[model samples]
Target: MGAATGSATPRIVIAGGGLAGLSLALALKRALADGIDVTMCDPALKRDPHGDKRSYAIAAAARRMLTALGVWDRVAERAQPILDMVITDSRLQDPVRPTFLTFAGEVDGNEPFAHMVTAGDLTAVLLEACRTAGVDLRPEGVKGFSIQGSRTDVTLTDGAVLPAALLVAADGGRSRLREQAGIGWISWPYRQSGIVATIAHERDHEGRAVEHFLPSGPFAILPLKAVLQADGTLQHRCSIVWTERAENVPTLLESHPEDLLVELERRFGLQLGKLAFETKPQAFPLSFGVARSFVAERLALLGDAAHVIHPIAGQGLNLGLHDAAALAEIITDVMRLGLDPGAADVLDGYERARRTDITAMGVVTDGLNRLFSNDVLPVRLIRDLGLGLVDRMPGLKRFFIREAAGLTRQEAPRLLRGETL
Candidate 1:
């Protein structure tokens, strides 16, 4: 099949079934109904759906997009709203981590700027939504592809061929499809690894998140919804993203449980009473990457395939969701106009819409990582002074809060604003 040409419904083949791909598939199905066909290919879909133990902070705009796609409601009860945030700069052994900045964490009145949700929970909900929406989920991943005029022919690992009006490489930062499309990617390792884990504490976190900027990196404590123990009592919990020097991460990860807990306690403090890991800590190397272009003829890139930045700002997932929302809107509008969704002009619109935003985020995160992940006394004094100034200015803080919530963009996609296409 060659993209259902001449009055037939157009087919869109997404080359990964992670959050980005699944969300895009559901969005297209929900918006266009019988007008389009969406197929997502990924080998991970055949494995245990709840295997990922990580969590993510979903910004206000991304939550709205999920709501528009009928996903947020299903996981709303499990989502923990971040009511406030605290920032401090100090060494690991500092007797006191003086707070340099604080934020109330609201954008428009009482609406929280972000919420924390487990990857397993959110992925499960998105997968279910895609299934209910009639999205085609394939167990085999896209092995390769070839663009042929108005359509791109996708070859699955099993050798089955799929011809689509457009091909999307949501496969990730190491996207084979993107490389095959001749897209240039600029990337570099941060030489730091982020250690993630869930912690059960004696006292409730009260929806407060904290970020401690140390010489090694930023150690973030994010609030999570309460979990019920086998004894039938509710236990308070929080998720942590502990960034450390890459060279030191292996020793930490391989350390004894007691030894690891000791290191964790040093940074975690006693704000939440005693703490213990509810899940084993896992580490992932940090990096920065951006595709030279987000789209090519008959092909497009989404999520990590387009960009990957340091987790210093916790905007990676939200940025990917933004990509899904923007691309879906552009493609839907193009199809509604009786035009080719994979046409050069259509792809250009998506690029034009996302390029500036992506570049700005990459720069901000890279700068923040470099500035905060060091112990130079002068640099620390300067950054702390800057943070103190920014904190004292309510207007500037509010502007930053709105920006983090993804609310400052006037031309955002309809789904991101919680509207149906």
Candidate 2:
């Protein structure tokens, strides 16, 4: 890419400095360096310090992306690799419950199911990455934007206006910039809220991830590794994502913590010993959402602004980060070819490349949510049989596992390969 003389850096304005937004900025700046000007606008200088503790099941590919961006070393300690995964059905009263497929991380290659890390840790590393990469991370909220012929003009809440050849919206599910760009989205409530909290258990997790399908929704217990307490006793940290129906939020949050832990223990079984209580309960509504289009004029959508899905599969953040990777590649190619980075023609290429994957994941996750969250006898039998069938077919089982881990046919972003830009 040519650095066309004085004061001519292809400008990019990123909105929302959360995991997705900050990551996009860091990745772009690292990839483009001074060839382009990167500015990230986020008002929240400090993260939600007292916020509900939650973790992300970032795929192996996402870890690669972070490594390339120079953020993984800081985040590695906070994450535990998922060495195994189990999907099953049935309860204690019944002895002959169906056994679903079990996937081992090392089945196909030296790949793991996913790495579990808290949201707080993810943000910290990304912020550091931005600082080191010299990304102009502006801490101001976005208010509105206008489409200029060759650029997009963004108005921040603090009465500052900036012009950029490209505008990327990582502002999350309810994106104000996406709306101001006249980008319509397709969204609906899923009648469920994901209740996220950390729990300390008596038994060691042994780097295992478990997802149980209950009547309410999928309950995911992700491992956070064993810690030695001050008394020298082993305590395991795990993030529990309890997707409950919206109507049951109040009752569940207000319910006794001990009783809730007991119920969770019963549902999870004895693989891990007795589960203990930790942290107050929290809840969030679950919804399967996606945007209608990804590109418009000089503006583009990335991360949550592009799509959202049921956390049952734990690929929400992975998908968002993947989008960031693809978009950066496309834009970099355009710059290399001596074309406008935000050209509509180039943006169309990006949209075309990602649309299929985004739509496919949306359908797959939504379908899985419906399939597992129901109690129909026929549905149960079919899924159980299907699960067992996949288990027997090692090839198909490994294929599905690899796909979930974001190790697939697509050309990996440099980060996934652990290469620094």
- Using Cα atoms with residue i matched to residue i, what is each candidate's TM-score against the true structure? 0.98, 0.93
For each candidate, the alpha-carbon lDDT, in order, equals: 0.93, 0.78
- Judged by whole-model lDDT over C-alpha atoms, candidate 2 comes out at 0.78
What is the C-alpha lDDT profile of model 2 across 1-421, one tens digit per residue?
A: 2222235778889888878778778877877788888888888745552252677888988888887777788888767988888776653345444558788865346757688888877887778778888888777888878887677888988899898888889889988878877888887788999887778877778888777776678777789856677999878888888777799788766778776766666656666666665677677787877888898887889988889888888888988887888877777767766678887777888798778888989899899989888778898889888888999998898799889878774666655556554
Clashes of 2: 9
Off by over 4 Å in 2: 1-7, 48-52, 91-98, 411-421
Q: For candidate 2, what is the TM-score?
A: 0.93
How well does candidate 2 match the true structure, expressed as C-alpha RMSD? 2.5
Worst 10 residues of 2 by lDDT: 90-99
- Candidate 2 pairs with clashing backbones: 64-415, 64-416, 65-415, 65-416, 192-286, 193-284, 193-285, 193-286, 194-284
